[model samples]
Structure formats: structure tokens, C-alpha cells
Target: MSPVKPTLKTIAEISGLAVPTVSRALNDAPDIGARTKILVRKIADELGYVPNRAGVRLRTGRTNVISLVLSTEHDMMNHTARLISAIAGEMQGTSFHMNITPYFPSDDPMKPIRYIVETRSADAVIMNQILPEDPRVAYLRERNFPFVTHGRTRWADSHPYFDFDNTAFGRIGVEKLVMRGRRNIVMISPPRNQNYAQNMIDGGTGAARAAGCSMRVMQGTTSDNRNEDIQLGVARHLAEFPETDGIVCSATAVAMAAVATLESLQHRLGEDVDVIAKEAVPFLTLFRPQMLTVHEDVARAGQFLAQAAIQAVRHPEKPPLQGLDVPTG
Candidate 1:
């Protein structure tokens, strides 16, 4: 059998020091001598010893964990994976660990948030798919829990968050289509219930109006729709709006669906129709030259979310850190 891994106790024995002394030295406690600490750290490194997370948690009254609550709907896209990678990367040097918890968006979103707070499962939380009047925001605020959101909420203006400028995305999407000489433009948007969806619509339609171009929003199709449903919706929209020269999508997945549907209808993209979308995945550009994409920096947003969570925990009374990043095609 493989031998057990080295621990603080093993270091204590090998170094001929008390377990408490070894612990303090490894932690670099001020009470320990600097020379002793240097010796212990070297030995610990040589032995490949690492601190026990449970022990550290018990000692510090902190779980040192960051909880990321996501909706099953949102997890369907590639952006979720990118965001998780970014958040984990940001926390790599810190004591905090990232834990993702997925739940059905149809269920009351507050259930999972409440569970985390009640169990103290994590030191801080990060979440996305924000609502206009978000209950999660209210609950976190009431508990004074440290949290960062990926999108804004209308419930409060003073919460730490990192959001893509959906309004700008809308405007850019419309402008791009106009520049391509496409007069009839339609946007495949997320559910109107989401605050960012409305923002995206306002930006796109507002810009279209200013440019004197014909623009319309096709309802009932959302970013969170099932793949088949998205395809069906796109097919139906195309059939109804046979004059649609351009399409704008809220997400990469939606753009993919639109492309597939257009291909099935024997519509050559970039000629018969032009498609533009906001995507977090890089591969979309590699395969889809026919589609123009606005890439959202989900990785940077993840870093900001982690940083905000840390700051919220360490300095709750400080002003909230709010940020927005523009997208690029």
C-alpha cells in the first residue's frame, strides 16, 4: 500500500519540535523565532507537507470557501465554465476555495442562498442571472453576508458586482448590422423578466430607431431555452419575418441555433443573412466566420467577482465595488 502523506505531526517529529511549535512556525506566527520559522518552512516544503484545511477553518472560524450559485438554465452555455475557471484562478493564491452549486431556475432561487447562509457552508458567495428586484440581494444584505454578483439588481445600488454592458451590446449589435447594409434587423433576446434583457433591448432598439432602420424583438425565445426549442423558435421567426436581413442574439448558444436554423433553410449566412451575438467562448470565432460575435470577457469578470467577494468579507463597511466591461466583436 502507498504510505500515508506527511502532516504537521510528521514535521514536528522529524524537526524534533513540539506539534504546537511546528504549527506556529509553519503558520509564521509572530511569537515564533524567525530562524525557526525559516527552518520549519524549508522542512515542510521538502517533506511536501501542506496545512489541513479543516484545522485552519476551525482555528480561524472561517470556512475559507467561496460559494457560486448558478441556475441550471445559465449552466447550459459555455460561459459558465469560463467564469468558473476565472473565479478559481483568482482565488488560487488565497485561502478561499470555490464551490459551485447548481439549482433549477424554476424553483425559488432563494432556497439555495438561504441554505448556504444557514449552514455557513462558505465564507462568501457569488451569483448570476440577476432579477430586477432580487430576493438573493435582499437576503445577503440582511445577513451582511459577503457576496458579489455577475449582474446588477434593482433592489439596491450599493452592492459589489461585475456586469457586461448589455445596453452597449445592443447598440453595437444594431450598428454592426446597419453598417453591413442590412435594413431589417431582429434581436433574439433573453426573457424580459431579467433586468439585463430589458437593458439589451433598450440599447438595440434605441440605436436602431436613431439610425432610421427597421428593428424588432422576437419574443418567447430566450438564452436559457433548450437547444431544440431555440432551433424551433428561430425557424418560426424566420418563417414569419421572411424579410429579416440581420439577426442579433443575446448569447453564443442562441447564435449557434440561429445559424443552424438558417443553414437548414438553405440560407447562406453573410450573404442572405447576417448574424451577430455576445459570446463568452473563444471557439465560436474559430468555427463561425459567417457570424460576427461580441466577445464578453467572462474570465476578467470572474476575477473581479472573486476580488469583490474577498473585499466584501474583509471590508464590509467599505463602498461597494461596481464594474462594467464593454464587449468587442
Candidate 2:
């Protein structure tokens, strides 16, 4: 015979609590005392009790799901994986679960958001790759949807977000190069349409001007381009502007490509051309001990985004939570 499946009634019987009390405790009801909740949850865990999502949604009008809409163009080797892991870990054992919605760069960014909203598939959404005036942000705000962004837009003050201070990162990267007596610099930035790209460009440009150095933002290619494409672009740019001695890269992959291009051209790293790059993980230094790096703490960003998204769903009336992480060293 098959083993018995655990249910709320089963947990109530095992814990010696009424069915309604057990349900309330499991749901983390405000009225339920802490000790009782702990006890009920412990027994439920031991019994392998899983809530019926259909029944719960039917009763509470909440799907208890959070959708994470990610772009396929992100750095798959480390950044994307770490972010997904962190968000999943944050949602574990909570009343809500996470669903990943992958979209291509060529597709409309609004497609997934519309599907989730129209189908009532999730109670909240978490997304990245924000623009200065993101249409998705505007749409969600107009519909009063609960969402949190990994990057911020112009209307960040009116919504929830957890963004790394790319502006500061850009400035710091340039300053580090300038301190080392490297004058002419080039930044391998992201797409011009991205809000963070502009922020970084502005900061880097301002810093270079203040220091009496020349800085240029590379054209025709972005950090999100393929490794070979980035390598070619870097090679071509270096060929045209051989005076570029200090390089700033927006992502790890971009840095790797730039370094490779420099190596191919027999340029000595740290001595001939130094590179400063942003990374979510600590492996960039391991890859090239001579290269300079700044950590973005993408895992921490993921945790913050998860919590902010849930908060927006549960307490829409409260002030939105906003977090900005500046670069350290």
C-alpha cells in the first residue's frame, strides 16, 4: 500500500491542535502566537505536509507565487546562476514559491509581465535590466502590480528596487586607473539604452575630466555581446585608439575578452594596460591576479529583491523599499 500523504488535518491530529488553528499557524497568521506556530510548523515539516496551492489561492485570491523574469543575454557562467540561487534560497520554506520566466533580448520585455498579470499566475514579480524610463515599470505601476526590480529606473522613488551603484563603480574604476598613472582610458560599457550604462558612462566621463585624463566609451559593441564579438570589438578599438592604457569593463566576461585582446596584441597586463571590472563573484581575481575588480554582491541583491517583492505584495500601502549598493575597493 502507498504511504499516507500529509495534510492539514493530519498535522492537526499529530500536533493535537484544531484543524483551523493548524491552518492559521501554517499560514503565519498575525493572531497566531509564535510558540504555537513553531510547534505546528515543526510537526508539519516532520510529516512532510505540503499546502494545496489551488485551494489556498481559491480561498485567499493569491497565487502565492513570485515570478522572476530574467533575460537570456545575462552572464550565464556566474552572475545569472548566483542570482537565481540566492532568490530561491530566500523563498525556501516561505508561503510563496518562485517561478523563472526567461526571455530573449530580441523579444518584447513586456510579454512575460503581461502574461503573468493577465493569467494571475503570480502575486509578485522581480525583474532586472532596467531602462531610464522603463515601460515595464510604468505598466506595472499603472496596474498597481506588486513588483521589485534588480535595477532602477527614473521612477525608482515610486517603486521597489535593489540596484548596485554603477555610477560609483565607474568613477572608482577610472580613479584607480588614474592613480596608477594610466591616462587614456576606455570603458567597455553595456548597451546605451540601459540606465546603468548611462550612469556608468557619466560617472566615468566626469571622473576622467576632473583628473585631466581622456576617457572614451567604446561604440558598436556592449558588455552583453558574445565573447568573440567583444574580443573583436576590443581589438578594433585598441587598433584605432592605441593610446588607451586603462580599460574599464562592465562585466566579468567583457573584462575577460578585453584582457584576451590585449594579450593577443602583446600588451602586458597591469604594466601596459590595466583593466578594472565589476563582478558578482570573487573568481575574477583568480582568473587574472593582476586585474583590478569590484564586487557587486549579486547574491545579496537577489535576497533583497526577493524580500522587497514579497513586502510589496503583502503591504502595498507601505513605503516601497529601495536599496543601493556602492562598490567597495
Candidate 3:
């Protein structure tokens, strides 16, 4: 004989709760109390009751799945496991599941994006580090693929995105340095193709003008995404301004090279220079204890991208371009 399959009624009866109450708890409805929710879920788990997500989606016209895409090879290089884990953990009780797809230039990035739209890889989509002339965005929007961005775009109002105030971050970073009595500041930014880099430069420039200091904004190599480009940029800054006292780097990868460059120039970490850095990964084991830390939590950004994409898919009319600032400590 086949095993008995559990349903909402069966779980509700076993848990000694009303079917409606059981449904709310199982579906993660906000009205349910903590203990009731816990008990009902425990009972459902014990009875092996799996909610029919497909059935729910069918009725609601939603797939409850999201697609997250990384635009650059550097993101692939620093594919943090913590980001995946964090996103999975964030979806513990949500009705949706997430799908992550990676597309590279060499792999014909456009091909995968096309497949995503046609094959229904997900109901909604999320992208990071978008190019100024991004065809993927235009293609998806033209076809009405509901999506969100981890970073903002120039055409942001017509689309939905959740991004940080990176411009403000740059201003704050540089301003902090200026207030501390450093005049010449070098900001290590990503290539111009990336919106974050341009925004950071604008912010730094504004802050520099306000502080009456000289700010030199330099670019990282777009090709290969190597540390050498960052190294060379830092080397230029070091040689150009031996009296440079403060630095702000967009990527932590640059900081690793910056540390090397600083040592080569015989500059002390705290006394000779001060730095404010952003990173997708957390700095857990820095030998230097005094570095001011700003954790970007790219992994956390991945999860947000996942959620926003699903929302856009569900309600195309209310596609949100939140531009959220994932707070850093």
C-alpha cells in the first residue's frame, strides 16, 4: 500500500488547531503568534506535510522563484559561500525559493539571460554591477521581465532596484578623512562601466571641494579584474602624492594590494595613512586591529536581490526600485 499523504486538514487535526489557523502558521502569515506558529510547524514537520507551492502559484499567477545574476567576473572570483548561506537562511519561512544564475562574457552572457526569460528560470530577476549600456536590462524590460538591481542605474525610476547610497558612502568616507586633518585623498574606484564607481567619484569630488582638499579618483582595470590593476593604481597614487594621508577603496581586493603598496613605500597603517574600505566579504582576521571597517555584505545584497525580484514578478504594477542601503558598521 502507498503511504498516506498529509494535507492542511490532517496537520490541523493533529495539532488540535483550526484549519485556518494551521494554514496561516504553515504559510508564515504575520497574524500568527510565536508559540502557536512553532507548535503548528513542528506538527506539520512531524507529519511530513509539504504545502503545495505549485498549486498556490498556479492560483495566484506567481512562480515564487527569483533569479540573481552577477554581471562581472570579479564577483565570480569572490563568490562568497557566506552569501549563498545567508540568502538561504533568510528564506526560511517565505513561500518562495531562489534560483541563482551566473553569466560571463566568454560564456555568451546574453544567451543565458535570454534562456532565463523564455524558459521561466524564475518569476523575477536580480542583477549586480550593471553596465551603463546594459543590453540585458533593456532586453528584459522590453520583454517585461520583472526584476530588481543590487545597485542603481541611470534609468532607475522606470525600473525596480534596491541599492545603497554609494554616492553618500564616498562623500562620508572622504569627509571622514578630511575632518581628521588629511588633505590629499586617493579614492580607489571600480571601472566607469560600473555605476558604483562613477557615483563614488562624484561623491568624492563633492566632498573634496567642500573640504578644500585635492582628490584624485583612479580606475581599476575592467579586463581580467586583477589585483595588478589595483596595484598599479595605488602605485601611481603613492608616487604622485608621497604626502597623501587618506585612502578610500571601493573593493577589498584593492585594499590587499594597497597594504602591499603602503609597505613598499614604508608607510605605517595608522600613523602614515588612514583608510576606509568597503568589501563584500567580512574582514575577520586582519593583522592590523585599528582599521575602520565598513562591511558591504555582498552576500546579504544577493538575498535582497532575490526578494525584490520575486516581488516585481508578483506585482508588475508595483515593481519596486527601493535602492536600499544595506547598513554597514
Candidate 4:
């Protein structure tokens, strides 16, 4: 038969101590002696004792849960999975738990934010797909909500965030392609509405101008629904711009399409046509070593977001405001 789960009473009985003393020892109350605390902890570890979160929540009035809000579109690109894994890794060994909630980006992205707040679903939140003037930031700040973002928003500067330096990614992407001795280059970028999209466009074009290389950008698909569209889009662009011999991709979906189109056009990667991309997940490099990629360290972004949310909740007055630029490999 399976053994019964151990509790404070079980520890007290085994240690020959009072129930209250055992409880104090487990909680590391200042009044308890260090020797007693160590003894209690050793027994608890051996017994595999698990704390009752319901009791803890009632005593502290804190859920000890962090909610991550992300877009469904990113799930296809493997970003959501990487971020969640990193956040969970950061939260390991802590009393806190991480929860992921996916939603579609809308004109009013604040709808999901309001839902989580109203339901008291989490103690803190982490959100992404930031806009220039994000209403979610304004609403969260107005309510004094404890939150962090994966990217920056112009509505506020106080909240913590971790973001990839897309401008630099764009600039460096062009540099990498240009180094391959290609003068006519084309970039497949995100929709113009996103702030990162424009940052990338400006960076790529500016760098190309300085290098005396010609560049053009084509708006690419962002959602999984249009997977084939990206491949066809690249094929069309290549057909139209026959002189194009280098490419930069902002999304993995587009990069995959670009590779297939290049093969169809009888162009060799890293030889006839050079390709580079900013990748959220690192597995792309493992599969296609010839296709050079710069990783954004989505896992580290998750770890930072997790820590930022907790700090924002516990120390609102002196919260840590962190802005991270993902390093290229």
C-alpha cells in the first residue's frame, strides 16, 4: 500500500516536539532555534512533506501564481513554448507557480488583462506583443497591477520588460548577408504595424545604405494559417527581383519558406544565395547549420519576466525595471 502523506503533525510526532514548535521550525520563524529548524527540515525532506498552499494563501492572501499572457500566433513559431519553459525553470524551487494563458491580439488586447484581474487568477502577470501606445499598460498601471512585459510599450516606463534588440538584429542581419558579397538583398519582415517591424526595416535599410548595397523589404505572414503563403511570397519576390542574391528573415516561418523557394530556384544556400534570420528558438540552427541564425534567448527572456513579475508584486515602490537586449550568437 502507498504511504500516507506526511504533515506537520507527523513531523511533530516523529521529532517528539510540540505541533506549534514543529510548525514554527518549518516556517523558519525567527523565534525558533537554528538547530531545531534544521532538524525539522531534514525530517520534512525525508518524509516528502508538501505544504498546503490553500492554508498559505489564506494566511498571506497571495495566490503565489504568475500568469503569462501571449498570442496564439507566436505558438506556431515555437516562441510561446520556449518562453514558458524558461519561466518555469526560473520559478522552480519557489512557492510560486507559472500559468500560461493564450489569447488573440485584438484592437482591445486589454480584454484578457481585465479578465485575469477581475477573476484574481494570478498574483502577477507577464504579457507580450507590445504596441507603441499599449492600452494594456495603461490599464494595468491604473489598477496598480503587478505585471511585466516581454517587450516595451510607450504608455509607461515604470514597468519591467525584457526585449530583443530588433533594430540591431536587422542591422547585423544585413551585415551578415553583405559579407557574403551580395549587393542586391531582400528582407522578409513582419507586418508594418508592429513596432519591432519598423525598427528592423530602418536598421536594415540604414545599414545597407552605409554599405552601398541595395535592399528591399517584403511584408511576410505572421500566423500559422498562411504557412504556404510565405513560401509562395518568397518565390514571387525572387521571380520579380531576379537580381536578389541575399535575404534576411524576421520570422522562422518566413525563413523556412525562403529556404524552400531558394532550392526551387536552383540556388545553393550559403553559396549562390546567403540567408540569415533572428530566431526565437535555437533548434533551427541544429537542423540547418548552413542557414546562419541569431538566437534571441527566449528562455532567458522568460526567466527575467518571471523574476520581474514577482519583484513588481513584492516591492512595487522600488521595483526593478530591467530592459534586456538579446545577445546574438
Per-residue CA lDDT of model 1 for 1-329, tens digit only, reads: 98789998898888899998997776546588978887887888898886777878789767778899998887455788899999999986454679998888678899989999999888889998888888888989888888899888885478999999999999999999999999999898888888899899999999899999989998677877887898998888888889999999988888888889999999999999999998887766676777888889999999999989988876688888888998764
lDDT of 3 by residue, 1-329 (tens): 99989998998788889988987776566688988888887887788878786776676655666766654565443433555665666666665676778766578667768888897757777666676667778898899888776667677878877666678778888888877778988887777777877787898899999989988875443323577766777778677678788888776666667777787778887678877776666561273565555666566565676566655764568647475664433
TM-score: model 2 vs. ground truth: 0.96
Candidate 3 — which pairs collide? 161-321, 162-323, 163-323, 163-324
If ranked by lDDT, best first, what sequence of candidates would result?
2, 1, 4, 3
Better of 2 and 4 by lDDT: 2
Quote the positional error of residue 13 for candidate 2 in Å. Answer: 1.6
Per-model TM-score on C-alpha atoms: 0.87, 0.96, 0.78, 0.84
Scored by TM-score, the top model is 2
Q: Model 3's lDDT to the true fold?
A: 0.71
Q: Model 2 off-target regions past 4 Å?
A: none
lDDT of 2 by residue, 1-329 (tens): 99988998898888899999998887767788989988998998888888999999998999989999999999988888999999999977567789999999899999999999999999999998899899999999999999999888989999999999999998999999999899999999989999999999998999999999999999888998999999999999999999999999999999999999999999999999999999988887898899999899999998988889888988899999999988866
RMSD values for the candidates in order, in angstroms, are 3.7, 1.3, 4.1, 3.7
Ranked by TM-score, top first: 2, 1, 4, 3
TM-score of 3: 0.78
In candidate 4, list every pair of residues with a backbone clash: none
The Cα local distance difference test for each model comes to 0.86, 0.91, 0.71, 0.79
Clashes of each: 0, 0, 4, 0
What are the per-residue Cα lDDT tens digits for candidate 4 across 75-170? 454677788888999976455788887787553567779988898778888998777677788888889889888777764467788888888888
TM-score of 4: 0.84
Deviation of model 4 at 200, angstroms:
1.9
